[model samples]
Target chain A: MAELSVRHLLGIKDLTREDIELIFETADHFKEVINRPIKKVPSLRDITVANIFFENSTRTRLSFELAEKRLSADVVNFSAGQSSVKKGETLLDTVNNILSMKVDMVVMRHSSVGAPHFLSRHIKANIVNAGDGTHEHPTQALLDSFSIRERLGQVEGKKVCIFGDILHSRVALSNIFALQKQGAEVMVCGPATLLPKYIGELGVKVETDVRKALQWCDVANVLRIQLERQGGDIAYFPSLREYSQEFGIDKALLDSLDKEIVVMHPGPINRGVELASDVADSEQAIILDQVQNGVAVRMAVLYLLAQKG
Target chain B: MQQQVILGKELLQVTLRRLCQEILENHGDFSNSVLIGLQPRGIYLAKRIQQILKEDLGKDIPLGELDITFHRDDFRRRGTPLRANATNVPFLVEGKKVVLVDDVLFTGRSVRAALDAMTAFGRPEKVELLALIDRCYTRELPIEADYVGKEINSMISQKVNVQWEGVDGGEEDKVWLVLSENG
Candidate 1:
């Protein structure tokens, strides 16, 4: 049996090249399993999984829960709103209490960076980070890389330019780790204000021009500006209009390129902001495929970890 | 490290022919029967048997592949994740008899997992097991193959290696009982 080196999937930074490959290979099998008439597999029937989402999310929460159910695992869902989290319990207290009920695995989404990593040290069960603050989103990066591989046949020797907010985007940081590990040259294309300090030390080129980045790469993973992550003191972008005009990915902007690059986004897509609706709905876009592939990617993660215990 | 050949190509061909004849006798036309290949290794034997049954009886029966990686009882006992084969059962098993095929029948745990996995498709009228090699007295579960090619004496420390032409990309079919690394 081929498996991950790490027990918990905390972030992409902790994953090696082979770990990512094993995940993609496993995801390839689960992708086929999900399309069959009986979409469920009786693999994790006895093992119970708990999905603890301290943050509000529509797609990630639903995707993790569905992946668990599809694997035939007994699932218990906990959100901050309905759970004892409203009663002012600590993260460890809420999770440890859930663990006391004999849960084998946890799928966690939190607003704090390193929350899953923090909980992993004190807990005994397996932990999968759905999305942890602006730190990293490992599964999203996996699916994005998987989608790019599906389009280009390989991730190595290909150019992947990530457009939009980088400082406040977990998707960007995780993808840079993932794509670079798979031998793809990565570039963060956005306003300099959104770009993090010493991002070049991560071995990625910082590009301010979106057109050249699109023209030079085979795929562009455009990220949203993160309206909530933005606040006073230091503005990431001067305004949404100026940012869209310069860094936004639209069909018209993409049409001017010599070749069409694959468009991708971690959704709750702001239609007219980071990417135009037409581009998101275009033939070149693989947003829906990414969503579809996310379930399989996560199923692979859970199924692999379930085998370890 | 030494191995002994139990059955070669000559006996393998004869065994498949006999299994086909036995199935032909049980269900004359195979009208309401579906053949399922237990995945990872069983699909080769299933495919060959399906081929022989088609050529002999002039029947095209439903053959599906079922992977029992998830249904295994010892998932947590291992340190690594199980590599899963594809489960490609296309037709329903609601009102049909399922003939489960595999390469070897050992402790019968895989067969048990296969039985559990069959429930997801639909309930079958009845299910039967067919294995090319059945190790006697190794029943961890109360399961037995209805049509077995050959019964061999073996120990838990030994492994049964079944090499099929279509499955293993070998020149011919053969079954060998070899000592495990620990043994």
Candidate 2:
């Protein structure tokens, strides 16, 4: 299983256990490369990558750019805010224009679902879905699982609970798939209005109580309250103060647990809203490790896809 | 296929002793020099050399292991993607004399990739190569070994297997030459 089974990493749903394992194994090597005095490698020198983000992003964009530069790949960045998309250019037209410049790979993040999937059917270059709306964020799921495997030795049979905003989270959906594929138990905890109705069909346990979910799991991956993505008409919770009082993880809640569970968060955290500042900066939290692992994992994804190209 | 033992355990020991003495001639006391082994197979030879040097010199010298998976030229050209081994180069290579240890010197491609990989650490003052088995007259690149254990004249179709004790649960250290009939 030296090569990945799929060419484009559209979602974790398209990946097998072996594909994820291969990516993790390759990421272990890149992790070593980044830690060295000279962090760059010339593996992708002959290839060019175009990171086309249809949505605004700071961390994912910078992480992808750093990964490309570390691999010595030529990079061209295109943002929808500044691009011709605002001038009524279609998604396909935008991508075709970038493809005309001889880009070997396209790392795209679109606000629409199935944007990368639709492009993969028509485009010639490799496609890596950075994040496609609320559909899936595959690399984020991979790095989360990798972080768990790094801290807990393995993902098999270990309990993991995803807390907060499960209704509109691509991270929650992807993590459920990735963790379940690796033989880990998953539970989603949030208000009933915030959790999707179809979450139970995905074979994950649902818990509304934060303490009960925390006590039952070995890892607690707290997600941010996506106010931007949440629709204006639907009130998922009563208020921010009420949501924090009910579901937010604080040090006192963590201290009440009989076991010391690992804490994680995919960033742009709302500080005191979902995760307390002390808990985010605590020794038990691996939020920083998740950020550092993002680059190596993205490097692994790009390097493997470049092999297929 | 035809198989033959090119170097037995006793003869391999004698050859290693001579190679160590030659290294001592060039790098006395090994104060400013380091031993770096290419990953996967080369590290076995490198570990053996380091062990013998430590026993003889009564001092532990610096040794590093470098993986060249990302530096290989045949990345997507090959049928299967290349898997990487752990690279454990803890010390900097800047301004220090370095010796790259490997079990066999083949088409000189691995050494070429190794030369490229070593630069990531730092620019070494000087560099040299040590090979336990030199498959002569088959190098595709303009590269040669600095220290050779034994030069065996063989066809490109012939395979050289250098076996070390305690590696893959093997009993003895021996080198075998297997000639494939297809070529």
Candidate 3:
């Protein structure tokens, strides 16, 4: 089981529990490499990776870039906003053009669902989906689970609740699938309008009440409200103040709990909205750790995928 | 398959003691030298060397474990991907003498990778190799051991196996040469 079960990491659903564990094991090694003084490896020196992003991203883009650089892989960054995508260039044409330059792997983030899957069908190079539309962000889910396992020892048989906007968050969906596969009890907590009707069929417990959801789980992974992704005209809730009063996680709320539930967030956090500023900077929050683990996890993903013959 | 014992428990004990004596002769007091074990199998022999050295010196010496999975040249050549182990080089190796310990020295590729992996810690003033079993006439590189316990000529199809006590239910430590019929 040294190699990953799958060739590409398009989504969490495509990964088995063993594959996830293997990634974690590899990530454990990369984590040590990154913490060292040199903080680099020559594993991918002969390989070239193209990071094609069709959507705007800050942390994920930088994290993937850092991961590639740390592995000593030659990197070419392509952002849709600055590319010929503005001139109506098709996805296939853009990728094929990159492949013509002898790229070995493509790490893409597109606004359309299954964009990487679509590319995999036509392209010869390996594809890693950073995020596709509101679909799956596999690396985020992996780093989150890795952070949880780092904090609490193991993910098996643990109660984990994903709190906040569920209908539009790829993090929530991937977390549910990854946690469930790893034998953790999952619960999704959010406003009813934000939680999709099909969520229950995924075998995760659904709760609209935030306090009860927090009380019932060992970990609370809070997500930001995807206001941009949400149709601008439609409002999921009445206002920000009311939503914060009902859903925002503050230090006082955490202090009220009988047990300390490890809090996590996939940044950039909407400060004072889903999570309070105090809680975000609190020692209990693993937000910074998740960000740091993102690079190691992505390095593990790239290093493993490049090994596919 | 055929198996032949190269070194039994008593011979191993004497070899380890002799290796420690040579180490103490070269690195007096061990204040400026560090022992580094290559990961997976080398750590066992390294621990034995460290223990024997400590018994003679009356103090503990710095030891570290290095994993060269990422530094290997055969990243995508093998059928199975390489898995990494933990590398706990807690102290800096800057301007320090490093002694790399391993259970067996076959093709010198792993030693080459270990040299590359050591750069992350810092530059070493000098480097030396220590192997309990040196598989003769099989080195793919121009690498030689400074402290050698025993040397044996083996075929490509024959594998050198080192079994430590309390590991894999073995009652005592032994080195065996395993010969397969195909080769």
Candidate 4:
């Protein structure tokens, strides 16, 4: 019953049910603000947010930038390739340099897991984890929840199937935790070698066959095959064509399921590999909904974290 | 805040019921009457009025909600843009007697903004304004509510906030005014 104030958003596991609901409610308020002719607010006036990204990103970085600017806060983009992070500068020292300029918040995306956790302890300003390697992308999970809740009215009791390479996807990990926390039954489907061992310990159902997993779920969230992050023998499958034929969600597969079952994909979609182009563009697909909800969810996060209380 | 408190919690409720009765008596046909509540508090008040009409006069009036923040002239000053809420009325507004509801009638700026916002949806036959409390000062525009709970004389520096259990639960129906330090 206490007033909600989110200082830092490092992971989905750090948020409670009430905290999630508050984010949704705050997003509902921001929804009205967005529909206005002059789409802006002065809530975070005089506040400066630094986006420190050490990895290649488009959606996550743009979302954080848009969210900060919408709140009328000054935004600064810091790239690892262009900055001292490439010249053997310590992470703490880089953060300290920005803090010296009186930054209010830091939204970071790093290739290493636990990077945000490491920064949270040292930084005085609020820290938002845009993505920290393959560990957890909490905001992505929140935006997914917002999209699902917007379409289905509620996430509780809904069956959600997360398909594709679960080993290297931070999105799959975050969605599994967030969806389960919201009372949705989560099922991850992928090749045996592509899935993590002991995934069930995270309270999710794991399966190797995509067809069987697609039968009972209300939503199918297909994750992109992270080819860039594959450092080991993760690609146990024969080829992209073989993977598509075996586990790809197509129109034929979608026809067998209930009409209400929705399709989703965190994009830069692999076309014919993990999901067919037709399925991604179908009416049942909420890919654009996820993008739009990203703004609302990020607004909720910034509002909750920036509150003085 | 050192402003005149014209209406308390008890008086506000009584006046709301009286306003409902007057609307029903004057516009008794109830054929094409729809109450559109503004976002946040107006939505709650519209529901209350709808319930009153249904209970007292045995008329089931249609209700809807309008979010006028986007149409506001002063949005650039308020920090952070918000998302739009569902304006859930499927019926046509053409030639319907639409009543706009709000919690407090301030500089009449919000109501003026609401009127401008409603035109894009459809043209109404007539539009009426209703408020829980009407402070009769700092009027930048020539606008007055058809139904008002109470009228108070106050300065622009004072802040008046009306909270309800329907919206801000646990501690509802509380009215507070904060005076500006400059005053």
Candidate 5:
């Protein structure tokens, strides 16, 4: 009886350690199935999943669509760019209208924070938060944790340092909750002004220095500095040049560590900013592995949610 | 808690040897036959038989594992997520005879699911059911094992516990008849 109690996967904040483990356990099976000659399963044949992305994304949307297709679920992709969302329809009316056609599950990415959480309360269908406005990306955190678990043998007691934009990045918050829940120590590394005021209360160790954080952790998940979220003219830091000089992860900075450690990034990589192109493509980098695992992790989340309905 | 000892290691060894020899009579080299262990439990028995074929009889057999957790008819009715195991059937079953190995043949629901799960890879030339313990006349479905070690008259409440030395904590092979709630 490894069923998760939640109707929606809104965030890691709402999921217990057991829910996370069950998702991983189920993901293990999906991982094997995807590698087979016939990379499809009949598990969710009758279930239809809708990918509703109000935000622009390439990797998360495609990975989720593939995951649904692999599970044999009929998928309908939606975006605000081409939908009634551009017209005058509200989020509730739009989702309910989609559900009127009986979309069993929705994997949504929205610009607004807590959009998935808001929709889950209003709709009967299961909602999975792909990414919300700096709130949480549960699946990203899950895959990041899953990747770390695969590399380090276990998530428990392993030190994970999440660097880059801490305040504006949903992945950083979700990883903190997920890694902490699974018995991993969390350290957040970024510019002092860029981190959130709530960081002090999140029970995570804050190290503004990336070099020191790298020395102190097992795996360093270097987050992409959210360029879109940052205003064009607004000065969060002195400049990108100063920010990179102090906080950016280059090969030289990574080499300063006692031993070469695992480096990760949630994709659409800033080749020269948060992580260097050399370090991003290095042997220790698991960026590609994270992309490959995203499909398996999403499949597990969707399958578990479908079982409840 | 009162029960009867169905088969000890000595008796069970003789029965399994006869069963493997019976398989050898029909499936000589087992080149065309593939042995599939049902998920979690049947795997041990499948491994045991495969070991005997390789060690004692010098027949190298192709062994695979099949997990029917998803193909189950009662999947929706069950409370928990069907914690899936690996289904490692690398070879195509298109023309191969599949020996579906399981521990106990009771209701035959698992065998039915295994048949459904096996079709995902390819349709087999033939399929055979092998059970370590067959509770005769207790099947909900009209199913019978072709290679049954022992036929015991077991109540719905009485469970047949088969322990292999490699898997369980027991020293040797053993079978125990224990009572359930309905007993």
Candidate 6:
């Protein structure tokens, strides 16, 4: 029998094809629960899921909350702005305090990379990394995989282009590993400065031109540019206009590619900077599908993780 | 009770090939058709069907999976439910002919629930059921497999399982028919 008991989804790199498939399968189950009149399952009836966000997040936090609630788990949201983190409590201590509340799972989003991994060691509760700094957002990657798998039928042997910010994107990093593992040829494209030098070492082809990457792939995942993470003289792109012309996915750039090619973005989208509003809102776009899949994927992650000791 | 056994591994492959041929012959154009397997055994069966169709007919079929535990009508009655397997359908199900594959068909509750679960994804052109073994009994629903391996009439207490190759790295296909009294 396939062991489905999985607790603590730390990163995409730790997941095997079986694990990925298990999540997809569980999400498929949740997909049914979601469409029900009550839209809730008693699987996690008395369990509690703590949403501890040390970093700011709207979509990720809400999605996790919805996922937990859908599984009938009691949810408690703790933001750094409202919690003991404001009173100089260390991250570990704050997490321990939350764990002391006897929550069954902790879905954490921190500004530091590997924060989830660190927390997993301290608490008995399952740890799910919502998004940590620029390290890895495992659920986002799985949802992207789910979205891609839904659109393409299978990720194996398909060409996937992940464009825009790679330097400070956990989503891009996670997708590179997840997609490649699922047998997709992953390509990363961005300004050389924004794209890491050793990214190609991850078995993904890194490109500097947007048009070329778009033409070569079946799916284009545009990443949001984190202006907050861009430091010093390296923010060389003069204006948003310049970035839009060079890196942004617009109508003309999309027109050159195959009509079957789908576009995606892990949202809170930067309207005109990394993606055009029209393209983001187009039929070829799966931005909303990404959000819908995010709930199902996170449910799968939580269900699997909670079952493991 | 006579042990209803599947003789060898080759028979399993042949069974799958026949099912694929039957599906192709009935469906004709596969452009609008998709196959979704219920998790675990069903997923494997779906993959096998996809392979047979690809090798025999040169048609690349869209294959996906569904985990039916959460959607089952008996979740509350069954205590803590088992963790669901991966559900991966990369294409839109709207207006496509969906063939639901499973290892064994018994009470038909699983297939009945699967049909209810599938409608949430999107409206499909039609959903045709396929199973390796159909233990003929009083089905909970009017659901019946469009394709079946061997139809066996069995008692409600009896267990009928269809085992395929590679289940435990064994190269033999074994069908186990066991009585509850033995346990």
TM-scores of the candidates are 0.93, 0.98, 0.98, 0.73, 0.92, 0.69
- lDDT at position B52, candidate 5: 88
Candidate 5 or 6, higher TM-score? 5
| Local distance difference test, each candidate | 0.89, 0.94, 0.93, 0.80, 0.88, 0.82
B1-183: candidate 4 lDDT, tens digit per residue = 254345567776787789898788767868878898988678887888898889976767888787765456654344554444555554657788998898889889889878876775578999999987787877889999998876766678777777666564625565666556454
The reply for model 5, stretches above 4 Å from the true place, is B1-8, B90-95, B119-125, B135-144, B152-160, B166-172, B176-183
- Residue B179's lDDT within candidate 5 is 62
The digit string of per-residue lDDT tens for model 4 on A1-309 reads: 322445788998888888788788778767655554445665566678899999989888888888888777899999898998878999899999988999988999998999999998887898889889989999899888888899999999999999988988899989988998899999999998788898889889988888789887889999997767554554567777778899888898888766658888878798888889889899999998888778878977886676631
- List candidate 6 segments past 4 Å from native: A4-6, A231-236, B1-68, B71-183
DockQ of each: 0.60, 0.81, 0.86, 0.12, 0.50, 0.12
lDDT of 3: 0.93
lDDT of candidate 5 over A1-72, digit per residue (tens): 578879899999999999999999889888877877668877788888999999999999999999999988
Question: Which candidate, 1 or 2, would have the higher DockQ against the true structure?
Answer: 2
Candidate 1 C-alpha lDDT tens digits along B50-168:
99989977778899999888778888786555777778888889989999999999999999999988887889999989999999987898999999999998898788999987554
User: By descending TM-score, how would the candidates be arranged?
Assistant: 3, 2, 1, 5, 4, 6
Compose the digit string of candidate 3's lDDT tens values, residues A50-133.
999999999999999999999999999999999999999999999999999999999999999899999999998989999998
- How far residue A124's Cα lies from its native spot in candidate 5, in Å, is 2.0
Worst 10 residues of 3 chain B by lDDT: B174-183
Select the stronger candidate by TM-score from 2 and 5.
Answer: 2
Task: Identify the runs in model 2 with alpha carbons over 4 angstroms from their true place.
Answer: B181-183
How would the candidate models be sorted by DockQ, starting from the highest? Answer: 3, 2, 1, 5, 4, 6
> Which residue segments of model 4 deviate by more than 4 Å?
A1-5, A231-235, A258-260, B1-183
- State each model's TM-score restricted to chain B: 0.95, 0.96, 0.97, 0.85, 0.92, 0.89
Q: Model 3 clash pairs?
A: none
For model 2, how does the per-residue alpha-carbon lDDT over A1-309 read when each residue is reduced to its tens digit?
A: 678889899999999999999999999999999998899888998999999999989999999999999999999999998989999999999999999999999999998999999999999999999999989999999999999999999999999999999988899999999999999999999999988988899999999999899999999999999978565887888889999999999999999999999999999899998999989999999999999999999999999999987
Ranked by DockQ, the better of candidates 3 and 4 is 3
